[model samples]
Target: MTQSASPPNRALLELPQVQRERLSHIDFKLYFLGELRRTDVADRFGTGPAAATRDIAQYKELAPENLVLDNTDKIYRPTANFVPLFDHAPQRVLTALSRGFGEGIGEELKPMVRCEFPMALSEPKMSILAPITRAIHRNKAVRVSYTSIESGRSEREIVPIALVNNGIRWHVRAYDRRRKGFRDFVFTRMENPVLLEDSPITDEEKVDQDVQWNRIIELELVPHPAHPRPEVVMMDYGMPDGVLSVKVRAANAGYMLRRSAIDCSPDHSLSGPEYALWLKDPLALYGANNAQLAPGYRNPRDDSENKPIKAL
Candidate 1:
């Protein structure tokens, strides 16, 4: 539901695609960046002042409560009652925030803003990605030539339920027929993907069957016990109570922990410079198939009683 949502300004749907896209851009700038100038719209769309004014006027007509014009600053600031007229994906917004926009738009056009962060290390080929994504959208299976670290290259049919970005790379969370279970297939390693339109997914292959993906677990992270300045770590992570709690799917818990360099060891044994936080309850990761991916993670049951840990 978060991936896509109905636009509040249903009237905007009646407009042509080109105009609607421009209006959406305006709405994005206002909602995310707090202020948007008329020239910002003009520069992004390569339009003149007159055309930009007309677009703004149309947006004002559509959602008068959304923005307020500041004559002194010549910027449109978001009003308190502002509700997004367009649904913006979190991934797209984060990309724009971190890398700036102007993605394939043009070199002449300026980026949304200056941004600095680690860029994507890999991207999947569109030829293979398209059909796989189409399969997910259509609720069907896909035939793919996949290469895995453990098994090497193999041809397989998979029922893809969702696409996951584990921070560093992309994955298709699918039901692997050969394995008789759900697994995450790296996108870049998949080749020659073909959508099997005739293959109707059975109840067993649906997302409901994937316990790790459906189950949510809350992780409690605190400053590394050995850290010299625990207060600084708390401030940095906005942990007023010296604890940062996050709820994530069991399928993604390991990736989240690894991505943030949180020490997942029960004893807080990780001494690396990258580790700023430690998982307060290593037992919280019980039943998480991907927990092995977490740095220094050890199953608490490996040394003690193997009882089911209560879900948070």
Candidate 2:
């Protein structure tokens, strides 16, 4: 037996303006207002009277509405009870339009286009998004299976409070049941998250604000000759200086330290040895203060008791 050809995709449907407008009018009536006559809606949508009338009839079949025809005006209007529906219909329509067009785009591109998009396209395998969102809205607890480079794999129940996106990644800040404190779980590392129906953990049990804030670390660096000298050294918050310092806040302090260590490496050619060497006080290296090195300054790898300054 011969196989029948597959149907074409619905995305190929390109109805004319009159038909589209008529369909929208019917949608407005059914979802927002009551019923609207063909001629009246067509006129509002700037279509010819005859076309409007025909569209109205076609739309009525697709989406039925309880519309009444005004004897004097000959126009149809929604019932009094349905009047408030118009207020929210436009926003709903906009949201639908946005969602229809914006599903797979990256978050950075979402702002350029008029739509909401997911943060990452790799389809994070261990996603905590669903459970976390549910927890936030319902005020419940969530059970999560998490994995990390150091921890390997662990299970914990948490009270999700907020979702955060820090440029490169997404995190859920929650009160960890296992740790008995607040912690951030990287969404990409979460697996098999399930929401609990039990009552929400109280705010008194929430993670301490001080502990969260203490996660931040400030590091100062003086440029070595082999390293690249930025046009202007930037420390925290884009503050310019001759020396570079960075303030990194992360749940994983070791990860941040490793990154800082890499950036402070003295092997790069553009940053001479003098600028490449990591200084004890990155802030003090700014301006003329760098001309003199204070006693007790020592390189982590260097074992010499006192070594003379090496030019880049």
Candidate 1 pairs with clashing backbones = none
Once fitted onto the true fold, the runs of candidate 1 whose alpha carbons sit more than 4 angstroms away are 1-39, 42-94, 98-110, 303-312
Clash count for each candidate, listed in order shown: 0, 16
Candidate 2 residue-wise lDDT, 139-242, digit = tens: 78888788866567888788887776544466776787777776667787888889888655776555445254345556565544344554433432254565
lDDT digits (tens) for residues 80-135 of candidate 1:
77888888888898777766666344454444567667778898888878898888
Please, what is the TM-score per model? 0.74, 0.39
RMSD of candidate 1 to the truth, in angstroms, is 6.7
Pick by lDDT: which candidate is best?
A: 1
